[model samples]
Target: MTEQIPVQPVRQVHLLLVDDHPLVRDGLRARLETIASIRIAGEAGTAEEALAIAASAPVDLILMDINLGTGNGISLTARFKTEYPHIAVIMLSMHEKTEYVNQSIQAGARAYVLKDAPAVEIIEAIDTVIAGGTYFSSGLNRQTASSDAGQLLTQREQSILKCIATGKSNKHIARELGLSVRTVETHRLNIKRKLNIEGQADLIRYALSNVIV
Candidate 1:
């Protein structure tokens, strides 16, 4: 009598979806569910929720967007890396800007992809990141000469950035840096113009990622 050999079960990639938009999550789930080797383990609309779910669930990869309300995706990615470094993260963002991409990378994301990219590319990014490789969307790997890379600042500006990362106000940073309020305001404006940070949150993310001080 001939004995039959048992086939080994292929491991499915467990994924956590983080996006504020319900449609986006549904669309992604539909597309990804079609792949036999992928499984949607969880979903989150905010970074805090994502972190909590990640802590409780078995996730192999996180498909995260960079614009989650309250907790931005970059900051969440950084926190996740700090708290749970074993899981891989692939940032699914509409941001094609060099600074945003740089921030995501600095925050420990394994991949970055624009939202408009083909579904196959997104899937490929997840696969690549899970395999211990880095991935970037096309035309996003290099910092251009006109890029935010040239956003230079003085020593004081660097110090102020460190302050900002700690959630300090202009007046508070001024007091800490031993500068006048007006001078601190000027430095803040310079930092904004130089770093191309559009909002206070962006400033914080940029500072946290740069950590020049």
Candidate 2:
């Protein structure tokens, strides 16, 4: 005689899609609905609607757009992390800009994925985040290598970087910081080396894009 055993079903992950565009929500629903382990809890076109749904319904994860066109997804993500610390959020953006990605991470998003990323990548992001890990778009991996450089900078270097972001000259930065122009230049070179940025314009752009806050 042989005994038969039944296999347990996979857990369903409740997902909420948040975007200002209805078409975007529809597209996301179409792509995510095909996954058997995922069950879409709801959809929202604005921060208010998302908050409402989350407050009243069961939502395990959120696929949120960085720019809602009418609201800010990063701010909403901060709010969500504050109120619903258990819910995981992933920011979706059209561009692979480090600025947006850094903001999203600060706001407590578990992952950042490009809007044009393949569905498989998105699915991978969901699985990874749900399984207690972080994920970023493959296209932005190289760009994000500089994202953590801010932490490696000294306070003086960061101040110089901020000044450069505002279009200040090295001489001006030195005068403002009560340091010699040569000292400022040394710090500037160190900043460039740490960030792996070669050109002055690129350094300025990076400084402007990555606000410490």
* Winner by TM-score: 2
The segments of candidate 2 whose C-alpha lies over 4 angstroms from its true place after superposition are 151-213
lDDT of candidate 2 over 85-139, digit per residue (tens): 9999998888666677777877888778889999999999899889876677766
Q: How many backbone clashes does candidate 2 have?
A: 0
Pairs that collide in candidate 1 are none
Please provide TM-scores, in order, for all candidate models, with all chains considered together.
Answer: 0.65, 0.69
Q: Per-residue lDDT tens digits of candidate 1, residues 67-182?
A: 88766999999988999898888989888777777777678887778888899888878776676656666534334211453334556877887888778888898888799998
